[model samples]
Target: MSSHRRVWYPYVSPFDPCPPIKAKAYSTPPSLFLGYQPPNLEQFTPMEALKIGTLWKVFYDPWYSPYEVSTEEDQS
Candidate 1:
């Protein structure tokens, strides 16, 4: 299995006006890893498919916000 998210460092110059960013992260689609659909793959229910945005379970990659702030109650 491969990582869904990847990170890379951008070129930073000392002569730049603003502060430089060290590393940046980006997400790739799950379909890129799948070569072809198999005969009988697991599938999500109708209600679940509508909520998840995908009918196939293998293709479901939940989106997580990088800038989302978690409250103290959510930690538990």
Candidate 2:
């Protein structure tokens, strides 16, 4: 005789009796983390996206911009 009393529900086949699952909501907008490759775009457009890798794209004025540093490294 088992010491534990177990309440067993009748076996229901096919349909799942588990609790309903809720979809996750995004609290914040997605950001491009370091070394992040957009996985979703891969399924749709792979070849086109590959032209630009982890590097950020600069359309214009990057060379003459104030942020540009001539030195190899800038601590400032």
Candidate 3:
């Protein structure tokens, strides 16, 4: 299967004072690959749908972040 995630190297200026990020990443939604919605698409469970913010599994495209900081609330 093809991945929705993509990576690229950004142009870093020598004159810039801050350190340059060698690579950056981003993702595209899975829905983009589909031409149209088909009949009887698979679905997630009721609780899973609420948590994932989508009912249909085919339409679910999770956000990918390089920096994810966990707080005390998340640990609990």
- Name the top lDDT candidate: 3
Model 3, 1-76: lDDT tens digits are: 5667779999999998999999998878888998799999999999999999999998887675757632422565
Measured over all alpha carbons after superposition, the RMSD of each candidate to the real structure, in angstroms, is 4.4, 23.0, 6.3
Every model's TM-score: 0.77, 0.16, 0.74
Poorest 10 consecutive residues of model 1 by lDDT? 67-76
Residue ranges of candidate 2 with Cα displaced over 4 Å:
1-15, 25-53, 57-76
TM-score of 1: 0.77
Error of 2 at 73 (Å): 31
Candidate 1: tens digits of C-alpha lDDT, residues 1-76: 5667668899999999999888887778888899888879899999999999999998988655556633422564
**Backbone N/Cα/C clashes per model:** 0, 0, 0
Tell me the whole-model lDDT of each prediction, alpha carbons only. Answer: 0.79, 0.32, 0.81
Q: Candidate 2's residue-wise lDDT over 1-76, tens digit each? A: 1111123345445567885433322222123222364443323234533653323232111122224543323442
Q: Model 2 clash tally?
A: 0
Q: Native-vs-model 3 lDDT?
A: 0.81
